[model samples]
Target chain A: MQENRSIPVMDVLIAVLLIAAGVASAMSARHLGKSVLEPIGPGAFPLAGSFLLIALSLLVIWRAVRVGTTKSNVDEFKPRPGMAVLALALTCAYFLVMQLEWLSFRWATVGYVTLLTAALFDWQPRKLPAAIVSGLIMGLGLTYAFTQVLYVDLPS
Target chain B: MEFLLPAIANVFTPMPFLMMLLGTTIGIVVGAIPGLSGGMVIALTLPLTFFMESTHALILMVSMYVGSTSGGLISATLMRMPGTPAALMTILDGFPMAKRGQPGRALGFGIMASFAGGMVSWLFLALLSPPLAEIAVRFGPYEIFSMTLVALMLISAVSAGSMIKGLLSGFLGILVSMVGVDPSSGALRLTFGVPDLETGFRLLPVILGMLVMSQVIGDIVNINQPIERVQTSFRSMFMSMNDLRRQWTNILRSSLIGTWIGILPGIGGTTAAIASYTTARNFSKTPEKFGTGTEDGIVAAETANNAAVNGALVPLITLGIPGSVIDVLLLGALIIHNLTPGPLLFQDSPEVAYGIIAGALVANVFMFIFMILGTPIIARLMYVSRAYLIPPIIVFCVIGAFAQGNRLFDVWIMLAFGVLGFLMMKAKIPTGPFVIGYILAPIAETQLRSGLMVYDSSFLPLLTRPVSAAFLVIAVLTLFWPFLMKRRKAPTAPAHLEDE
Candidate 1:
């Protein structure tokens, strides 16, 4: 499936990151000692894997560039901008708020789910109430199930 | 065999039985929904199983697996959509049959065929897994390491999208697994001085984030899209004697196909179903009627996919290699309970092995019963709003991640991987390799290192030993096959580079 090519700029970026990661892994492995007697150190596998990764990442970049230079890229998927941003923001904020102890885990989840659902549905007037109710059920039901039945402690 | 009685007794006991019932019910509901999958459900529910006995957990997961395969028929027949990927072919004939006013009859055929498939495949699973484990027991570290490499290469080659992306994902998974203290040297290799990083990422949260949370986020992004609902009533919910008599051969054939495919590593039920459906059509004297609301098509599709469910368990139980993404979670569940899989599992925890095999049989029976009785209720759930469903799953994802180490760091790791998974999906990269890579990397590394130690760091043994050499040769071929195929197809379409 790699013959027809659209230049994926994002993929190029990922390849660069992968290259950087490989370098970083190699640097990290250098700190761990490896000798002839102990050929397999803690860092041995990581070093080998990272070098393999670096080589592969270069191959990916070469292929991506080759495809982009040859012809126009395929029609790419365009996710709804508003929906994408809102979902991402809410997810990050949910993690941050819970981590910072701004609110109890249960409350933060309830608020996040309720708002996220409404936003995702674009606040259709007739569907708004049901969406809110659904969020509430999900939030509370999960809290109870996890804490009571599963015995998982939610951050308080 | 000595453990068989205890295994049966353990599974039939009250708590495990109840969990199976609950798991089956939940599986049906999740499977009936278009976006949700049995894998995601198991991943999300894994933490809850963390405290349970390994046998009970196996029973629960196995029942859910069976129920989900059966549950797909509800949506496949009612709507044109397959509830699960395995049901994709079912829509060809199932939906058409439902539209032709024989909804109940079509549903009956699917249900009955699924049962027959499950029974036939369960026979293979029960009989084959032990002997396979026995054979696997003889494998040395070199053989094991080479075999693991072969599994990784094969999975990367067969994944849905670009082979390179799949390989990259798998290697990336290996990198991720190497983040903490090295198991061999007792030295911190990649923790970056963070105490949490000392242990690296736990498998549960990593899996939950990628499979469940990523899916939830993706679903939420497209939440505005509406489903096409079908209104239908049940009638004649039983396969006639003549229909059963005529389709017996098809059922048996499809089941055997599924079982054999399931034994092969990395491939899943969808392939089995498609293969069975195609074979059945070719063999049918009335080929013209195959896809035109024919019972033969539904039977072939449903039977094979369900049979594959049990077939997939063979390698998982014996070799510790997951055949599909869902089975990876099953492996994760086993690890969570401190029950290591592989040939030693059969020798050490014979009861767990026997219990799982027995539980699958019981679960299949329960799945058939539940699908018949719970059809009406499950049909309603198919229309449940993504807004409602997606949010709860996210909540569960968080709880699942947090429950793993009772740490916030793991939760963040989950969110990070979720985003990574989402982007990978968007890029047309298959997440299958990533999970398999993540799960198998440690195994491969450990085994390779041990093998090297055994051979005094001579790589020659890997290529000189017959079994190991064969595996290494296959791995090389598996990795190159995609590129070879792509090269052959290159002249046809220069635009197909994105097919990865």
Candidate 2:
């Protein structure tokens, strides 16, 4: 069976969108400085990268035409939604917890890591408790190790 | 003689010796795990080294690097599942040999070949790095720019079928690179209403998205496919001395191939191992034995890949340039300790520099010993289901991101990159070079800008300067060389396809 042609087209479209976004952002940046600040300014490396991106995007578009329908079903594939959500939730909790000084980054880490780990290992429900316990042990261990032993500063 | 004396003092110190073993043990375990690589092991350890004594710290790090590369062969031989990417080629014959009841002989060939390749590469590094460092000292912005151009061209080499799609992915990454605040102008590029995207994509999340999350997505979708476990024993892991004797030539040839490939930056162990295997098969008297359980196949692949580890270090230690993303992370780790990696590293701190070289030697030795003893331990871990493993890994990723910087921004970036990375992988885009490009961009910019600053607002000196011009030439040649090779191989590929 043959694969769909839209995959490469979509890839090209995504590249174009990225290029447009990059160029538009650069234009907005020009307004902030009026003229680019000299010698490592607010706009220098990014503007250069933007122009390069535009050129590269155009190249991507051109190549998409030549690569038309060989046999790869790019759209037939789906991004792993389940694991990604689990990972995303963990991140959101880590960040949201960072804002509360009373919660303390150290203390919040224990709660978040423990809960996320328990949810992830649904294999052995009995092992879930062990996972939670290990998470707590590791979190506190790291807090002491990085903050006290290594003298690295952590969020209070 | 001058180098020999200081190397002795720094290398044999009791703490350094102990650390070398400790690092090697950790590195072997990490590398032997299916999901981890020597590069990642080095990266995480890099930050911690800042607080350590220079010699002791270096001994540990270099040892781990060597050990991890060697350790990958364990899973590759036993399960046909490679613990690391470079070991991918090893499974072709290593697993077949195991299935044929010759796992012990297959292992013996793999180890001896690894030792020889690593030692040979170490010799090359010891003799060659100083002279190469001298040459690197003459390089300027143009040279660095050209070097990056060559490194970027490596993406073409990695792309199996089509170079254009690979390049497009790379360029797409470069475009993504544009979205952050401009280094030269501080202009924000792509953050729309969401303030979070403004700092541009932090690499870890993107990498995680591509590597960890994308993989999970596929696994979850395909959860209905049942995977069977193949159980083997520790008793079968021993080799006869005669088996080692017979495979010596393959081991030596592959070791040489591995060491030379390792010397070149951008080209990695996977390429070297594959190249050596191809050469070994081509040169063999009995080619039919290769896939059906040949020791020569295992020897060729394992040796080259292990040696490639040492070879990648050449540029990092001598040029203050990294060969890969993990190397860049290593560079970051060094900076955190106020240590700059490059040619000057040898002159400024001979002990730390030589300790790395000596430690690599020790690491390989220890890797050999531990791999023999530790194979059973690692093989057992494979029995632990991914379902049991996934949750802890997810948590670690979170802690790793937030711990590096207390910013939740980093955690978000890590998740985003993880998704992007996964999709990119599925689409057949090579993520290795993109990560290389993202890390090298700042270096390329700073050097070019500084060089321009010296020339009174003219970009002409970049061409007119002899040293710079040479690098530009090399860069241009690098970009075009693949096209030239493909043109030459055109007729051969068709005939080859027919034979296949």
Best by TM-score: 1
**Top-DockQ candidate index:** 1
Q: What is the C-alpha lDDT of each candidate?
A: 0.81, 0.66
Candidate 1 per-residue C-alpha lDDT over B384-437 given as tens digits, one digit per residue, 9 for 90 to 100? 777667666777788888887889888888988988888777666677788888
- Candidate 2 CA-lDDT value: 0.66
Q: Estimate each model's TM-score.
A: 0.91, 0.85
Clashes per candidate, residues 3 or more apart or on different chains: 9, 24
DockQ of 2: 0.32
True contacts kept of each: 0.49, 0.29
RMSD of each: 3.9, 4.3
RMSD after Cα superposition, model 2: 4.3
Report i-RMS for every model: 2.7, 5.1
